[model samples]
Target: MTPPRDVAVVAYARTDHQGPAEGLSEAETLLPVLHEVLDRAGLAPGEADFTCSGSSDYLAGRPFSFTLTLDAVGAWPPIAESHVEMDGAWALYEAWVKILTGRADTALVYAHGKPSAGDPRDVLTRTLDPYYLAPLWPEPASLAALQARALADAGHTAGPDPAADPLAGPPAVADGAAAVVLAAGDAARRMCGRPAWIRGADHRVEPHALGLRDLTDSPSTRLAAERAGAFRAPVDTAELHVPFAAQDVVLRRALRLDDTVTVNPSGAAAGPLMVAGLIRLGEAAARIHRGASDRALAHATSGPCLQHNLVAVLEGDA
Candidate 1:
Protein backbone atom coordinates (compact mmCIF):
# COMPACT_ATOMS: atom_id res chain seq x y z
CA MET A 1 0.00 0.00 0.00
CA THR A 2 1.25 3.51 -0.89
CA PRO A 3 -0.37 4.78 2.35
CA PRO A 4 -2.91 7.60 2.54
CA ARG A 5 -1.80 10.95 1.07
CA ASP A 6 -2.09 12.59 4.48
CA VAL A 7 -4.07 11.49 7.53
CA ALA A 8 -3.17 12.75 10.98
CA VAL A 9 -4.66 12.68 14.42
CA VAL A 10 -5.57 16.27 15.21
CA ALA A 11 -7.18 15.76 18.60
CA TYR A 12 -7.48 13.11 21.32
CA ALA A 13 -9.44 12.72 24.59
CA ARG A 14 -10.26 10.09 27.19
CA THR A 15 -12.48 9.47 30.22
CA ASP A 16 -11.48 9.50 33.93
CA HIS A 17 -11.72 5.69 33.67
CA GLN A 18 -12.83 4.23 36.96
CA GLY A 19 -13.67 0.58 37.28
CA PRO A 20 -17.46 -0.15 36.90
CA ALA A 21 -18.05 3.49 35.83
CA GLU A 22 -20.67 3.76 38.66
CA GLY A 23 -23.98 5.50 37.79
CA LEU A 24 -22.89 7.11 34.52
CA SER A 25 -24.77 6.08 31.39
CA GLU A 26 -22.77 5.12 28.26
CA ALA A 27 -23.77 8.35 26.56
CA GLU A 28 -22.71 10.31 29.62
CA THR A 29 -19.41 8.45 29.78
CA LEU A 30 -18.63 9.24 26.11
CA LEU A 31 -20.14 12.68 25.43
CA PRO A 32 -17.59 14.72 27.36
CA VAL A 33 -14.60 13.15 25.62
CA LEU A 34 -16.26 13.52 22.23
CA HIS A 35 -16.89 17.17 22.89
CA GLU A 36 -13.35 17.59 24.19
CA VAL A 37 -11.88 16.31 20.92
CA LEU A 38 -14.09 18.60 18.88
CA ASP A 39 -13.19 21.51 21.10
CA ARG A 40 -9.51 20.72 20.76
CA ALA A 41 -9.82 20.64 16.97
CA GLY A 42 -12.06 23.75 17.03
CA LEU A 43 -14.60 21.77 15.01
CA ALA A 44 -18.26 21.03 15.45
CA PRO A 45 -20.00 17.65 15.45
CA GLY A 46 -21.71 18.44 12.14
CA GLU A 47 -18.37 19.37 10.61
CA ALA A 48 -17.07 15.81 10.80
CA ASP A 49 -17.27 14.14 7.41
CA PHE A 50 -17.78 10.78 9.10
CA THR A 51 -18.13 9.34 12.60
CA CYS A 52 -17.60 5.83 13.89
CA SER A 53 -17.43 4.14 17.29
CA GLY A 54 -16.70 0.83 18.93
CA SER A 55 -18.62 -0.72 21.85
CA SER A 56 -20.16 -3.99 22.90
CA ASP A 57 -23.75 -4.36 23.99
CA TYR A 58 -22.50 -7.20 26.13
CA LEU A 59 -20.48 -4.72 28.17
CA ALA A 60 -23.44 -2.42 28.83
CA GLY A 61 -25.71 -5.42 29.55
CA ARG A 62 -27.90 -4.22 26.67
CA PRO A 63 -27.89 -4.42 22.88
CA PHE A 64 -27.31 -1.36 20.63
CA SER A 65 -25.15 0.48 23.13
CA PHE A 66 -23.80 2.65 20.32
CA THR A 67 -27.26 3.67 19.11
CA LEU A 68 -27.76 5.77 22.24
CA THR A 69 -24.32 7.39 21.86
CA LEU A 70 -25.46 8.81 18.50
CA ASP A 71 -27.79 11.02 20.52
CA ALA A 72 -24.75 12.42 22.36
CA VAL A 73 -23.38 13.50 18.96
CA GLY A 74 -26.83 14.91 18.19
CA ALA A 75 -26.84 13.27 14.76
CA TRP A 76 -29.65 15.40 13.40
CA PRO A 77 -30.03 15.45 9.61
CA PRO A 78 -28.18 12.12 9.90
CA ILE A 79 -24.47 11.50 9.14
CA ALA A 80 -22.12 8.94 7.71
CA GLU A 81 -21.45 6.59 10.62
CA SER A 82 -20.62 3.05 11.60
CA HIS A 83 -19.96 0.92 14.70
CA VAL A 84 -17.80 -1.98 15.75
CA GLU A 85 -18.11 -4.37 18.70
CA MET A 86 -14.32 -4.10 18.98
CA ASP A 87 -12.14 -1.37 20.47
CA GLY A 88 -11.79 2.20 19.27
CA ALA A 89 -8.42 1.47 17.69
CA TRP A 90 -10.18 -0.72 15.12
CA ALA A 91 -12.81 1.93 14.76
CA LEU A 92 -9.97 4.37 14.00
CA TYR A 93 -8.69 1.95 11.38
CA GLU A 94 -12.13 1.74 9.77
CA ALA A 95 -12.36 5.53 9.65
CA TRP A 96 -8.86 5.77 8.22
CA VAL A 97 -9.86 3.44 5.43
CA LYS A 98 -12.86 5.62 4.78
CA ILE A 99 -10.54 8.55 4.16
CA LEU A 100 -8.20 6.49 1.99
CA THR A 101 -11.09 5.53 -0.25
CA GLY A 102 -11.81 9.23 -0.94
CA ARG A 103 -15.11 8.81 0.84
CA ALA A 104 -14.45 11.29 3.70
CA ASP A 105 -11.80 13.86 4.54
CA THR A 106 -12.24 13.81 8.32
CA ALA A 107 -13.58 11.42 10.94
CA LEU A 108 -14.45 11.24 14.62
CA VAL A 109 -13.63 7.93 16.31
CA TYR A 110 -14.54 6.89 19.87
CA ALA A 111 -15.02 3.78 22.01
CA HIS A 112 -16.30 2.88 25.52
CA GLY A 113 -17.11 -0.15 27.70
CA LYS A 114 -18.06 -0.83 31.30
CA PRO A 115 -16.28 -4.02 32.21
CA SER A 116 -17.35 -3.33 35.78
CA ALA A 117 -21.02 -3.76 34.88
CA GLY A 118 -20.62 -7.56 34.72
CA ASP A 119 -18.13 -10.31 35.31
CA PRO A 120 -15.62 -9.11 32.71
CA ARG A 121 -14.10 -12.55 32.68
CA ASP A 122 -17.41 -14.19 31.90
CA VAL A 123 -18.26 -11.59 29.30
CA LEU A 124 -14.84 -11.96 27.67
CA THR A 125 -15.55 -15.64 27.09
CA ARG A 126 -18.09 -14.59 24.47
CA THR A 127 -15.15 -13.48 22.30
CA LEU A 128 -13.98 -17.03 22.00
CA ASP A 129 -15.17 -19.52 19.39
CA PRO A 130 -18.80 -20.06 20.26
CA TYR A 131 -19.18 -23.79 19.58
CA TYR A 132 -15.77 -25.04 20.76
CA LEU A 133 -14.12 -22.43 22.99
CA ALA A 134 -17.00 -20.71 24.83
CA PRO A 135 -18.18 -24.02 26.25
CA LEU A 136 -14.83 -24.48 28.02
CA TRP A 137 -15.40 -21.31 30.08
CA PRO A 138 -11.81 -20.16 29.62
CA GLU A 139 -11.69 -16.65 31.06
CA PRO A 140 -9.11 -14.17 29.67
CA ALA A 141 -6.88 -14.18 32.76
CA SER A 142 -6.47 -17.97 32.81
CA LEU A 143 -5.55 -17.93 29.15
CA ALA A 144 -3.10 -15.09 29.68
CA ALA A 145 -1.65 -17.02 32.61
CA LEU A 146 -0.91 -19.88 30.29
CA GLN A 147 0.94 -17.48 27.96
CA ALA A 148 2.84 -16.06 30.92
CA ARG A 149 3.98 -19.54 31.84
CA ALA A 150 5.26 -20.09 28.33
CA LEU A 151 7.34 -16.92 28.57
CA ALA A 152 8.68 -18.07 31.96
CA ASP A 153 9.68 -21.51 30.70
CA ALA A 154 11.61 -19.66 27.98
CA GLY A 155 13.56 -17.67 30.64
CA HIS A 156 11.45 -14.50 30.38
CA THR A 157 10.68 -12.91 33.76
CA ALA A 158 7.85 -10.51 34.55
CA GLY A 159 9.85 -9.18 37.52
CA PRO A 160 13.53 -8.87 38.41
CA ASP A 161 13.55 -12.33 39.99
CA PRO A 162 15.91 -14.44 37.87
CA ALA A 163 13.98 -17.52 38.96
CA ALA A 164 10.75 -15.94 40.27
CA ASP A 165 9.37 -15.56 36.67
CA PRO A 166 6.24 -13.31 36.63
CA LEU A 167 4.07 -14.67 33.81
CA ALA A 168 3.77 -17.86 35.87
CA GLY A 169 0.83 -16.10 37.56
CA PRO A 170 -2.41 -14.41 36.47
CA PRO A 171 -2.66 -11.12 34.55
CA ALA A 172 -4.54 -7.94 35.51
CA VAL A 173 -7.47 -6.11 33.82
CA ALA A 174 -8.67 -2.46 33.85
CA ASP A 175 -11.58 -0.49 32.33
CA GLY A 176 -11.76 2.82 30.41
CA ALA A 177 -12.77 4.86 27.29
CA ALA A 178 -10.90 6.84 24.55
CA ALA A 179 -11.60 9.16 21.56
CA VAL A 180 -9.58 10.73 18.72
CA VAL A 181 -10.19 13.02 15.73
CA LEU A 182 -8.56 12.43 12.34
CA ALA A 183 -8.31 14.85 9.41
CA ALA A 184 -6.70 14.67 6.01
CA GLY A 185 -4.28 16.98 4.26
CA ASP A 186 -5.55 20.58 4.42
CA ALA A 187 -8.08 19.71 7.10
CA ALA A 188 -5.30 18.25 9.25
CA ARG A 189 -3.13 21.35 8.80
CA ARG A 190 -6.05 23.59 9.71
CA MET A 191 -6.97 21.64 12.84
CA CYS A 192 -3.56 21.51 14.55
CA GLY A 193 -0.23 23.24 14.06
CA ARG A 194 1.54 19.96 14.76
CA PRO A 195 -0.58 17.14 13.48
CA ALA A 196 0.67 13.63 14.24
CA TRP A 197 0.80 12.14 10.77
CA ILE A 198 -0.24 8.52 10.61
CA ARG A 199 2.61 7.06 8.62
CA GLY A 200 1.18 3.54 8.63
CA ALA A 201 -1.50 1.38 10.26
CA ASP A 202 -2.36 -2.33 10.08
CA HIS A 203 -4.25 -5.02 12.02
CA ARG A 204 -4.21 -8.82 11.97
CA VAL A 205 -5.96 -11.77 13.65
CA GLU A 206 -4.80 -15.24 14.75
CA PRO A 207 -6.66 -18.49 14.98
CA HIS A 208 -9.01 -18.84 17.96
CA ALA A 209 -7.56 -22.08 19.33
CA LEU A 210 -4.68 -21.34 21.70
CA GLY A 211 -3.57 -24.96 21.93
CA LEU A 212 -2.97 -24.95 18.18
CA ARG A 213 -0.57 -22.00 18.12
CA ASP A 214 2.84 -21.07 19.45
CA LEU A 215 2.41 -19.34 22.78
CA THR A 216 5.82 -17.63 22.94
CA ASP A 217 5.50 -15.32 19.91
CA SER A 218 2.62 -13.13 18.76
CA PRO A 219 2.94 -13.51 14.98
CA SER A 220 -0.21 -11.50 14.49
CA THR A 221 1.28 -8.49 16.25
CA ARG A 222 4.64 -8.99 14.56
CA LEU A 223 3.03 -9.05 11.13
CA ALA A 224 0.85 -6.06 11.88
CA ALA A 225 3.84 -4.09 13.14
CA GLU A 226 5.77 -4.91 10.00
CA ARG A 227 2.83 -4.03 7.80
CA ALA A 228 2.55 -0.71 9.62
CA GLY A 229 6.15 0.04 8.50
CA ALA A 230 7.51 0.33 12.05
CA PHE A 231 10.83 -1.04 10.86
CA ARG A 232 11.07 1.63 8.18
CA ALA A 233 11.26 4.42 10.76
CA PRO A 234 13.00 4.87 14.09
CA VAL A 235 10.72 5.15 17.13
CA ASP A 236 11.61 7.41 20.05
CA THR A 237 8.72 6.30 22.22
CA ALA A 238 6.45 3.26 22.25
CA GLU A 239 3.09 2.87 24.01
CA LEU A 240 2.25 -0.81 23.93
CA HIS A 241 -1.02 -2.42 25.06
CA VAL A 242 0.47 -4.98 27.36
CA PRO A 243 -2.24 -5.97 29.86
CA PHE A 244 0.20 -8.41 31.41
CA ALA A 245 3.44 -6.65 32.30
CA ALA A 246 5.52 -9.32 30.58
CA GLN A 247 3.75 -8.84 27.25
CA ASP A 248 5.52 -5.49 27.18
CA VAL A 249 8.75 -7.37 26.67
CA VAL A 250 7.09 -9.55 24.02
CA LEU A 251 5.88 -6.55 21.98
CA ARG A 252 9.12 -4.60 22.40
CA ARG A 253 11.08 -7.55 21.11
CA ALA A 254 8.60 -8.16 18.30
CA LEU A 255 8.83 -4.55 17.13
CA ARG A 256 12.59 -4.47 17.85
CA LEU A 257 12.14 -1.47 20.19
CA ASP A 258 15.00 -1.17 22.66
CA ASP A 259 16.53 1.06 25.36
CA THR A 260 16.67 3.98 22.91
CA VAL A 261 12.87 3.90 22.95
CA THR A 262 11.04 4.99 26.10
CA VAL A 263 8.35 2.50 27.05
CA ASN A 264 5.10 3.43 28.84
CA PRO A 265 5.97 6.21 31.33
CA SER A 266 2.31 6.32 32.44
CA GLY A 267 3.23 3.75 35.13
CA ALA A 268 2.82 0.00 34.76
CA ALA A 269 0.32 -0.22 37.61
CA ALA A 270 -2.42 1.63 35.68
CA GLY A 271 -3.88 -0.49 32.87
CA PRO A 272 -7.06 0.79 31.18
CA LEU A 273 -9.57 -1.55 29.57
CA MET A 274 -10.85 -1.82 25.95
CA VAL A 275 -9.46 1.64 25.26
CA ALA A 276 -6.01 1.03 26.76
CA GLY A 277 -4.32 -0.09 23.55
CA LEU A 278 -5.99 2.58 21.47
CA ILE A 279 -5.05 5.19 24.05
CA ARG A 280 -1.44 4.14 23.55
CA LEU A 281 -1.70 5.36 19.96
CA GLY A 282 -3.27 8.63 21.10
CA GLU A 283 -0.54 9.14 23.67
CA ALA A 284 2.16 8.51 21.09
CA ALA A 285 0.51 11.04 18.80
CA ALA A 286 0.34 13.54 21.66
CA ARG A 287 4.07 13.24 22.19
CA ILE A 288 4.67 14.10 18.54
CA HIS A 289 2.10 16.89 18.69
CA ARG A 290 3.86 18.44 21.67
CA GLY A 291 7.34 18.14 20.05
CA ALA A 292 8.31 15.72 22.79
CA SER A 293 9.22 13.03 20.24
CA ASP A 294 9.82 12.85 16.49
CA ARG A 295 8.63 9.32 15.73
CA ALA A 296 6.67 6.77 17.77
CA LEU A 297 4.95 3.40 17.69
CA ALA A 298 1.55 2.35 19.10
CA HIS A 299 0.05 -1.10 19.52
CA ALA A 300 -3.34 -2.62 20.43
CA THR A 301 -4.28 -6.26 21.21
CA SER A 302 -7.41 -8.38 21.23
CA GLY A 303 -8.53 -12.02 21.80
CA PRO A 304 -7.18 -14.46 24.39
CA CYS A 305 -3.40 -14.77 24.62
CA LEU A 306 -2.81 -11.79 22.32
CA GLN A 307 -4.25 -13.58 19.32
CA HIS A 308 -5.25 -10.40 17.47
CA ASN A 309 -3.18 -7.21 17.20
CA LEU A 310 -2.91 -3.78 15.55
CA VAL A 311 0.03 -1.41 15.15
CA ALA A 312 0.53 2.13 13.82
CA VAL A 313 3.51 4.41 13.39
CA LEU A 314 3.24 8.16 13.94
CA GLU A 315 5.73 10.77 12.75
CA GLY A 316 6.10 14.54 13.01
CA ASP A 317 7.53 17.02 10.52
CA ALA A 318 11.27 16.85 10.16
Candidate 2:
Protein backbone atom coordinates (compact mmCIF):
# COMPACT_ATOMS: atom_id res chain seq x y z
CA MET A 1 0.00 0.00 0.00
CA THR A 2 1.14 3.56 -0.61
CA PRO A 3 2.46 5.44 2.44
CA PRO A 4 0.19 8.01 4.07
CA ARG A 5 0.86 11.68 3.45
CA ASP A 6 3.15 13.35 5.99
CA VAL A 7 1.14 15.46 8.44
CA ALA A 8 2.60 18.07 10.79
CA VAL A 9 1.22 20.17 13.64
CA VAL A 10 1.74 23.83 12.84
CA ALA A 11 0.21 25.77 15.74
CA TYR A 12 -1.35 25.33 19.20
CA ALA A 13 -3.30 27.38 21.79
CA ARG A 14 -4.88 26.62 25.14
CA THR A 15 -7.05 28.47 27.65
CA ASP A 16 -6.12 28.91 31.30
CA HIS A 17 -7.11 25.76 33.14
CA GLN A 18 -9.27 26.45 36.16
CA GLY A 19 -11.76 24.83 38.48
CA PRO A 20 -14.71 26.70 36.98
CA ALA A 21 -15.46 28.71 33.86
CA GLU A 22 -18.75 29.99 35.27
CA GLY A 23 -19.17 33.15 33.19
CA LEU A 24 -17.91 31.81 29.89
CA SER A 25 -20.15 29.89 27.51
CA GLU A 26 -18.62 27.18 25.34
CA ALA A 27 -18.44 29.63 22.48
CA GLU A 28 -16.69 32.20 24.64
CA THR A 29 -14.24 29.61 25.90
CA LEU A 30 -13.35 28.55 22.36
CA LEU A 31 -13.33 31.84 20.44
CA PRO A 32 -9.98 33.11 21.67
CA VAL A 33 -8.21 29.80 21.40
CA LEU A 34 -9.59 29.37 17.89
CA HIS A 35 -8.28 32.77 16.90
CA GLU A 36 -4.85 32.22 18.40
CA VAL A 37 -4.12 28.90 16.72
CA LEU A 38 -5.33 30.14 13.35
CA ASP A 39 -3.33 33.34 13.73
CA ARG A 40 -0.23 31.38 14.61
CA ALA A 41 -0.77 29.25 11.53
CA GLY A 42 -1.39 32.38 9.45
CA LEU A 43 -4.96 31.27 8.70
CA ALA A 44 -8.12 33.31 8.95
CA PRO A 45 -11.40 31.76 10.13
CA GLY A 46 -12.86 29.19 7.72
CA GLU A 47 -9.54 29.12 5.87
CA ALA A 48 -8.51 25.59 6.80
CA ASP A 49 -9.61 22.91 4.38
CA PHE A 50 -11.29 21.08 7.26
CA THR A 51 -12.27 21.58 10.91
CA CYS A 52 -12.96 18.97 13.58
CA SER A 53 -13.66 19.07 17.31
CA GLY A 54 -13.63 16.76 20.30
CA SER A 55 -16.02 17.34 23.19
CA SER A 56 -18.51 15.43 25.31
CA ASP A 57 -22.16 16.44 25.28
CA TYR A 58 -22.52 15.12 28.80
CA LEU A 59 -19.94 17.63 29.95
CA ALA A 60 -21.98 20.40 28.41
CA GLY A 61 -25.31 18.93 29.61
CA ARG A 62 -26.66 18.97 26.04
CA PRO A 63 -26.54 16.99 22.85
CA PHE A 64 -24.43 18.30 19.96
CA SER A 65 -22.64 20.60 22.39
CA PHE A 66 -19.60 20.72 20.13
CA THR A 67 -21.54 22.53 17.43
CA LEU A 68 -21.85 25.53 19.73
CA THR A 69 -18.22 26.42 18.99
CA LEU A 70 -18.63 26.32 15.22
CA ASP A 71 -19.79 29.90 14.97
CA ALA A 72 -16.79 30.99 16.99
CA VAL A 73 -14.62 29.89 14.07
CA GLY A 74 -17.01 31.03 11.37
CA ALA A 75 -18.77 27.94 9.93
CA TRP A 76 -20.56 30.16 7.47
CA PRO A 77 -20.24 29.49 3.70
CA PRO A 78 -19.98 25.79 4.72
CA ILE A 79 -16.76 23.98 5.59
CA ALA A 80 -15.86 20.34 6.08
CA GLU A 81 -16.54 19.75 9.77
CA SER A 82 -16.88 16.77 12.08
CA HIS A 83 -16.76 15.99 15.79
CA VAL A 84 -15.70 13.23 18.17
CA GLU A 85 -17.13 12.51 21.58
CA MET A 86 -13.67 11.52 22.76
CA ASP A 87 -10.57 13.55 23.52
CA GLY A 88 -9.23 16.16 21.11
CA ALA A 89 -6.34 13.82 20.47
CA TRP A 90 -8.74 11.38 18.84
CA ALA A 91 -10.24 14.18 16.83
CA LEU A 92 -6.67 14.93 15.80
CA TYR A 93 -6.43 11.29 14.73
CA GLU A 94 -9.52 11.75 12.56
CA ALA A 95 -7.98 14.89 11.09
CA TRP A 96 -4.74 13.02 10.52
CA VAL A 97 -6.67 10.42 8.56
CA LYS A 98 -8.49 13.18 6.69
CA ILE A 99 -5.19 14.62 5.54
CA LEU A 100 -3.66 11.19 4.93
CA THR A 101 -6.56 10.11 2.74
CA GLY A 102 -6.15 13.27 0.62
CA ARG A 103 -9.46 14.61 1.84
CA ALA A 104 -8.03 17.91 3.05
CA ASP A 105 -4.74 19.79 3.12
CA THR A 106 -5.25 21.45 6.51
CA ALA A 107 -7.41 20.84 9.57
CA LEU A 108 -8.18 22.59 12.82
CA VAL A 109 -8.75 20.48 15.94
CA TYR A 110 -9.92 21.48 19.41
CA ALA A 111 -11.64 20.22 22.63
CA HIS A 112 -13.18 21.58 25.81
CA GLY A 113 -14.84 20.46 29.05
CA LYS A 114 -16.19 21.88 32.30
CA PRO A 115 -16.32 19.18 34.95
CA SER A 116 -17.18 21.70 37.68
CA ALA A 117 -20.69 22.12 36.36
CA GLY A 118 -21.87 18.75 37.60
CA ASP A 119 -20.99 15.70 39.63
CA PRO A 120 -18.06 14.34 37.61
CA ARG A 121 -17.97 11.11 39.57
CA ASP A 122 -21.56 10.35 38.66
CA VAL A 123 -20.91 11.23 35.05
CA LEU A 124 -17.77 9.08 34.88
CA THR A 125 -19.64 6.16 36.43
CA ARG A 126 -21.98 6.11 33.45
CA THR A 127 -19.04 5.21 31.18
CA LEU A 128 -18.38 1.93 32.94
CA ASP A 129 -19.92 -1.45 32.22
CA PRO A 130 -23.62 -0.66 32.28
CA TYR A 131 -24.69 -4.06 33.51
CA TYR A 132 -21.95 -4.54 36.08
CA LEU A 133 -19.88 -1.50 37.04
CA ALA A 134 -22.10 1.53 36.42
CA PRO A 135 -24.38 0.46 39.22
CA LEU A 136 -21.48 0.70 41.68
CA TRP A 137 -21.00 4.44 41.01
CA PRO A 138 -17.26 4.18 41.59
CA GLU A 139 -15.51 7.53 41.54
CA PRO A 140 -12.65 7.79 39.06
CA ALA A 141 -10.05 8.20 41.80
CA SER A 142 -10.94 4.99 43.59
CA LEU A 143 -10.73 3.08 40.33
CA ALA A 144 -7.36 4.66 39.52
CA ALA A 145 -6.18 4.05 43.05
CA LEU A 146 -7.05 0.40 42.72
CA GLN A 147 -4.81 0.21 39.70
CA ALA A 148 -2.13 2.28 41.43
CA ARG A 149 -2.21 -0.02 44.43
CA ALA A 150 -1.98 -3.05 42.20
CA LEU A 151 0.97 -1.51 40.35
CA ALA A 152 2.73 -0.76 43.64
CA ASP A 153 2.27 -4.31 44.85
CA ALA A 154 3.97 -5.33 41.63
CA GLY A 155 6.90 -2.90 42.44
CA HIS A 156 5.82 0.38 40.90
CA THR A 157 5.51 3.20 43.49
CA ALA A 158 1.96 3.82 44.58
CA GLY A 159 0.31 6.88 43.12
CA PRO A 160 -0.76 9.61 45.55
CA ASP A 161 -3.72 8.53 47.65
CA PRO A 162 -6.49 8.75 45.07
CA ALA A 163 -8.94 10.49 47.37
CA ALA A 164 -6.41 12.24 49.57
CA ASP A 165 -4.52 14.18 46.96
CA PRO A 166 -6.76 16.64 45.15
CA LEU A 167 -4.19 17.38 42.49
CA ALA A 168 -3.74 13.74 41.56
CA GLY A 169 -7.38 12.80 41.97
CA PRO A 170 -10.79 13.64 40.58
CA PRO A 171 -10.68 17.25 41.79
CA ALA A 172 -7.80 17.85 39.42
CA VAL A 173 -10.05 17.79 36.40
CA ALA A 174 -9.03 21.00 34.62
CA ASP A 175 -11.76 23.23 33.19
CA GLY A 176 -10.36 24.50 29.91
CA ALA A 177 -10.14 24.15 26.15
CA ALA A 178 -7.23 23.77 23.72
CA ALA A 179 -6.66 23.87 19.96
CA VAL A 180 -4.11 22.75 17.36
CA VAL A 181 -3.55 23.40 13.68
CA LEU A 182 -2.33 20.73 11.25
CA ALA A 183 -1.02 21.00 7.68
CA ALA A 184 0.61 18.73 5.12
CA GLY A 185 3.90 18.76 3.25
CA ASP A 186 5.34 22.13 2.23
CA ALA A 187 2.37 24.01 3.62
CA ALA A 188 3.40 22.74 7.04
CA ARG A 189 6.98 23.84 6.42
CA ARG A 190 5.85 27.21 5.16
CA MET A 191 3.84 27.92 8.32
CA CYS A 192 6.23 26.73 10.98
CA GLY A 193 10.03 27.09 10.97
CA ARG A 194 10.39 23.53 12.25
CA PRO A 195 7.25 21.53 11.75
CA ALA A 196 6.81 18.57 14.09
CA TRP A 197 6.12 15.93 11.48
CA ILE A 198 3.98 13.07 12.62
CA ARG A 199 6.03 9.97 11.86
CA GLY A 200 3.39 7.55 13.14
CA ALA A 201 0.25 7.47 15.30
CA ASP A 202 -2.02 4.69 16.58
CA HIS A 203 -4.66 3.93 19.21
CA ARG A 204 -5.68 0.66 20.89
CA VAL A 205 -8.24 -0.54 23.40
CA GLU A 206 -8.21 -3.53 25.75
CA PRO A 207 -10.93 -5.59 27.40
CA HIS A 208 -13.36 -3.22 29.11
CA ALA A 209 -13.69 -5.49 32.12
CA LEU A 210 -11.28 -4.08 34.68
CA GLY A 211 -10.99 -7.46 36.35
CA LEU A 212 -9.84 -8.97 33.07
CA ARG A 213 -6.84 -6.63 32.76
CA ASP A 214 -3.51 -6.29 34.52
CA LEU A 215 -3.15 -3.05 36.41
CA THR A 216 0.64 -3.13 36.57
CA ASP A 217 1.24 -3.21 32.84
CA SER A 218 -0.38 -1.16 30.06
CA PRO A 219 -0.68 -3.64 27.22
CA SER A 220 -2.86 -1.27 25.18
CA THR A 221 -0.36 1.55 25.62
CA ARG A 222 2.51 -0.74 24.68
CA LEU A 223 0.71 -1.97 21.59
CA ALA A 224 -0.26 1.52 20.52
CA ALA A 225 3.28 2.81 21.02
CA GLU A 226 4.76 -0.06 19.06
CA ARG A 227 2.30 0.38 16.22
CA ALA A 228 3.01 4.13 16.24
CA GLY A 229 6.74 3.47 15.52
CA ALA A 230 7.89 4.64 18.95
CA PHE A 231 10.31 1.72 19.09
CA ARG A 232 11.82 2.38 15.67
CA ALA A 233 14.01 5.10 17.21
CA PRO A 234 14.66 6.60 20.62
CA VAL A 235 12.65 9.68 21.53
CA ASP A 236 14.23 12.57 23.45
CA THR A 237 11.01 13.69 25.08
CA ALA A 238 7.65 12.23 26.10
CA GLU A 239 4.37 13.95 26.94
CA LEU A 240 2.25 11.44 28.85
CA HIS A 241 -1.41 11.82 29.83
CA VAL A 242 -1.29 10.00 33.14
CA PRO A 243 -4.37 10.71 35.28
CA PHE A 244 -2.45 9.84 38.41
CA ALA A 245 1.27 10.39 38.90
CA ALA A 246 1.79 6.73 39.74
CA GLN A 247 0.39 5.70 36.38
CA ASP A 248 3.47 7.36 34.89
CA VAL A 249 5.50 4.30 35.84
CA VAL A 250 3.20 2.04 33.86
CA LEU A 251 3.47 4.20 30.74
CA ARG A 252 7.26 4.45 31.06
CA ARG A 253 7.61 0.68 31.23
CA ALA A 254 5.18 0.18 28.36
CA LEU A 255 6.86 2.74 26.07
CA ARG A 256 10.40 1.70 27.08
CA LEU A 257 11.18 5.28 28.06
CA ASP A 258 14.63 5.83 29.49
CA ASP A 259 16.15 8.45 31.80
CA THR A 260 17.20 10.38 28.71
CA VAL A 261 13.60 11.19 27.89
CA THR A 262 12.17 14.27 29.59
CA VAL A 263 8.50 13.92 30.50
CA ASN A 264 5.58 16.37 30.94
CA PRO A 265 7.38 19.68 31.27
CA SER A 266 4.09 21.57 30.91
CA GLY A 267 2.94 20.22 34.30
CA ALA A 268 -0.57 19.42 33.08
CA ALA A 269 -1.53 18.32 36.59
CA ALA A 270 -4.85 16.54 36.18
CA GLY A 271 -5.35 18.04 32.72
CA PRO A 272 -8.65 19.13 31.21
CA LEU A 273 -10.89 16.35 30.00
CA MET A 274 -10.83 15.82 26.20
CA VAL A 275 -8.14 18.49 25.98
CA ALA A 276 -5.02 17.37 27.88
CA GLY A 277 -4.18 14.74 25.31
CA LEU A 278 -4.11 17.37 22.58
CA ILE A 279 -1.97 19.56 24.84
CA ARG A 280 0.51 16.71 25.22
CA LEU A 281 0.89 16.46 21.47
CA GLY A 282 1.04 20.22 21.14
CA GLU A 283 3.61 20.53 23.91
CA ALA A 284 5.75 17.85 22.30
CA ALA A 285 5.40 19.59 18.95
CA ALA A 286 6.19 23.00 20.46
CA ARG A 287 9.44 21.64 21.81
CA ILE A 288 10.31 20.40 18.33
CA HIS A 289 9.16 23.64 16.68
CA ARG A 290 11.50 25.65 18.88
CA GLY A 291 14.47 23.29 18.26
CA ALA A 292 14.28 21.95 21.83
CA SER A 293 13.63 18.39 20.77
CA ASP A 294 14.50 16.31 17.71
CA ARG A 295 12.11 13.45 18.32
CA ALA A 296 9.32 12.95 20.83
CA LEU A 297 6.42 10.73 21.81
CA ALA A 298 2.97 11.83 23.03
CA HIS A 299 0.25 9.68 24.59
CA ALA A 300 -3.47 9.89 25.47
CA THR A 301 -5.82 7.56 27.33
CA SER A 302 -9.56 6.94 27.31
CA GLY A 303 -11.77 4.62 29.41
CA PRO A 304 -10.76 3.64 32.92
CA CYS A 305 -7.35 2.46 34.07
CA LEU A 306 -5.71 3.11 30.74
CA GLN A 307 -8.05 0.64 29.10
CA HIS A 308 -7.85 2.58 25.83
CA ASN A 309 -4.68 4.28 24.62
CA LEU A 310 -3.32 6.43 21.81
CA VAL A 311 0.34 7.04 21.03
CA ALA A 312 2.08 9.16 18.45
CA VAL A 313 5.71 9.44 17.41
CA LEU A 314 6.75 12.90 16.14
CA GLU A 315 10.01 14.13 14.61
CA GLY A 316 11.28 17.58 13.67
CA ASP A 317 12.93 18.39 10.37
CA ALA A 318 16.70 18.06 10.50
Q: Each prediction's TM-score against the native?
A: 0.93, 0.95
Best by TM-score: 2
After TM-score superposition, the amount by which residue 55's alpha carbon in candidate 1 deviates from its true location, in angstroms, is 1.1
- Mark the regions of model 2 whose C-alpha exceeds 4 Å error after superposition: 1-3, 158-169
Candidate 1 weakest lDDT stretch, 10 residues: 158-167
Candidate 1: which stretches are off by over 4 Å? 158-175, 268-272
For each candidate in the order shown, give its overall lDDT on alpha carbons.
0.80, 0.86
Per-residue lDDT over 202-266 for candidate 1, one digit per residue giving the tens place of the 0 to 100 score:
99988888778888788888899889998886889888887665566577778887779888755
Error of 1 at 29 (Å): 0.9
Q: In lDDT terms, which candidate is top?
A: 2
